[model samples]
Target: MAKITYIEHSGKRHEVEVANGLTVMEGARDNGIPGIEADCGGACACSTCHVYIDPSWVEKLPAKDSMEEDMLDFAWNPDPARSRLTCQIKVTPALDGLVVQLPEKQI
Candidate 1:
């Protein structure tokens, strides 16, 4: 299992054990972590699952796709380099210590 750390806007952090092949949004939703609404259910249609990957681990994840890039434009606090849809970040052994920070607002 990979460990994921979710940091909230208020600076609260929660770590959850995620099974391989699971999406970051799924892990947060399953653990009842606030901030990631995932309104599109991981279909890559909504930006509600937006999260900021910690700079340290950003290089390990796959590059964002066109759809995600379009949706990210609709997200708050969009960081060209760090913004990503949690739904698109799959958990793998290589991403063991993934850390994602939630945006202040998820509209």
Candidate 2:
């Protein structure tokens, strides 16, 4: 399992243990971490699952596909350098200590 930390906009933090092969969005949702709506249910079709990867872990993740990039445009206050759809990030042992920060809003 990979341990992921999720920081909310107000600085609240939630640490969750996620099984490999699941997506980051699943980690957040399964753990009931607030702020990730996951309206599309990890389908990568909506931006409600948007999150900002901690800079240190950004390079550890795979590059975003055009679909994710396009969906991110709908995220609230999207950061070109840090914005990512959690549904697009597959959990792995290599991401054991990953951290992601949630935005102020998701709609």
* lDDT (10s digit) by residue, model 1, range 7-107: 99999999999998889999999999999999999999989999999999889899998999999999987999999999998889998888999999998
What would the TM-score be for candidate 2 when compared with the true structure? 0.98
Clashes of each: 0, 0
lDDT string for model 2 (76-99, tens) is: 999998999999999999999999
The residue pairs that clash in candidate 2, if any, are: none
After best superposition, candidate 1 residue 14: deviation in angstroms?
0.2
Q: What are the TM-scores, per candidate, against the unseen true structure?
A: 0.97, 0.98
Q: Which 10 consecutive positions of candidate 1 have the poorest summed lDDT?
A: 89-98
Candidate 2 residue 59 Cα shift, in angstroms, is 0.9
